[model samples]
Target: MDGTTLYAVDGGIARITLNRPGARNALNDQMIGELLDALDRAKHDDGVRVIVLTGAGDRAFCAGADLDGLGRDGMGVNDVRDSAPFRLFTAFPALGKPIIARLAGHAVAGGLGLAAACDLVIAADDVKLATPEVNVGLWPMMIMAIINRNVAPKHAFKLYYTGSRITAAEGREIGLVTEVVPRADLDARVDELAGVIASKSPLGLRRGRDAFFAIEGRPLEDQVAYLLSELVELAGTEDAKEGITAFLENRPPDFRGR
Candidate 1:
């Protein structure tokens, strides 16, 4: 609420922007809390079908955690376990709605964690990504779990160990980014994807995304069974019925998020 983060909803999409351009939109405790709050708002708002997270300014999507704000003291186990920044990472998947990261510039350390937490990430072709905690005598311990899931283990370890950076195209190759486009095309590309996703059945998106996160660590057989039941539940939703009828009638479906 300190204006370090901005949140707005329009056209069924919730836009959450980190507003600290002067600091390259670095994550501070307040900013992390604001972002988590915004995510919660969007998740509960029936009118919001999609969320887009981005940083202010063209210089950087995020330069990572604000070292000054993070301070130089080791924390007790309780403090470490209850850190607010950790909420930002977990909130995305728990929201049960699609989140797209609009990366206009570099994303390093915690910044990369934020992007990786999103369901999809679209970055400018010239943008870069890195996990440079090692360069500063620190480890990206909080984000490692997310980075591990998104990037190949060997490649991720190499980046973490060497403190190297990768271009957006390279990020796409490593499965860290979903799409890369010219800087000028970034907004259009993000809007296009958000609009397309926003037009889908909200109930379907929420249910599917929820199932996605839930079945992640399950066995293959269990996953198949759970997914089958999830599909049956989805089929019973009013939006699903309307979607089917609309398709059969060659008409646009009006989903009410039922």
Candidate 2:
């Protein structure tokens, strides 16, 4: 664990928390680096079947990037694309495991991007989300790619143009959030969802997730052909064979991630 982030694993779920509640869990360079490291650690850990990302307090999942920290080193506009936050944003799709964002509070700017990048977002009903970079004389540049993928173009444009905050229910309706529950029920809901994902075959989950990302933007025929090939390959894995056998025997499958 680093100062900016906390990492823990239990019951096949890796929990990575942004530990800067004092700063509303804003992303600084150090936090971004630590977050990427934690994600890498979880990705390589065979025992970790699912991941949950949240902040240290109920006030915010993350407020946004640390604006005060930006340009501290005379950073140029062109260099923004190569910054730590950019790398962290790109890292999510390559993890090959389900990531659930537990948004107990507001997720703004890059924070909203972080939640949108996750495979699923379980947000507290009281929470708000926004891409309010425009309010600060900037734009949600780095997060736009991820956000656009999750939210419809018109809705995304509205967010970028208005810099308005939307409720968790609105976020769900716009596809930014997977589910929303009362604040009291957030933890229980996240755990239940994570536990169910972790119980699946790890190998299957990994391959299936990889395919989910890979087939994006491909021609319809190409996507179908690629998925067919993937299915054939997956069917030959030991875990797949075991899964089929277990189904026939009316028992739970013991997947070894083979």
Candidate 3:
């Protein structure tokens, strides 16, 4: 919103870009606030069915927080719970719409958390992802929750302990990245994937996303019972009825987010 980030919606896709290319698109307080604002805007916009998040530069998708600005305002332990990064990461689960991270370059520290928070991550083959906070005498405390959910404990521990960078391919292998494409094909691939996701029923997508997050950490029996109720409710929606009818008629369904 303040030139620190860019927000644009076209053809049901909201593109939120980190604009501090000169600083490797690092997150400062202003950038983080602007990003949260963009996400909120997209979340409330009915026309936006999908979100694409990326940085403005080729050098790094995001190099993480701007360390120089961390304590500029005398931030302390008392402020950790209300920090912008904490709110941003927590916002993802409640956003309802799908988010696809476009990683054309490196994603490190909190940047990797940003990608992991998304529903999908499409990275360039040359991209590198890491949690190098240990190298700087700090830990990725805020992003640890997000990264852990996306990656297995063992692989995540190795990254945290060694402060090592992994290739995009390795990231996919370890479940942090969804797909890896060549740099030249990254934009096209991401766009294609985003388009496909955007064409789905908005109500279905929102309810399904909500259901998945709701079922996490629940007992197996409870999860199945909850999902069964959700499925029955979803099947009764207008979009679902239309989708079923259209299938029988060999035509595309017109979903109105119902």
Ranking of predictions according to lDDT: 2, 3, 1
* Candidate 3, position 83, lDDT: 66
Compared with the true structure, the alpha-carbon lDDT of candidate 2 equals 0.92
Local distance difference test scores for all models: 0.89, 0.92, 0.92
Q: Residue 106 CA error for candidate 3 (Å)?
A: 0.4
Per-residue error (Å), model 1, residue 226:
1.1
The parts of candidate 2 lying over 4 Å away from their true place are: 71-81
Which residue segments of model 3 deviate by more than 4 Å? 71-79
Please, what are the lDDT tens digits per residue for candidate 3 over residues 58-90?
Answer: 899999889875444324647765767678889
Q: Which ten residues in a row have the lowest lDDT in candidate 3?
A: 69-78
Query: Residue 206 in candidate 1 has what lDDT?
Result: 86
Candidate 3 lDDT at 68 equals 76
List RMSD in Å for every model shown: 1.5, 1.6, 1.5
Task: Sort by TM-score, best first.
Answer: 3, 2, 1
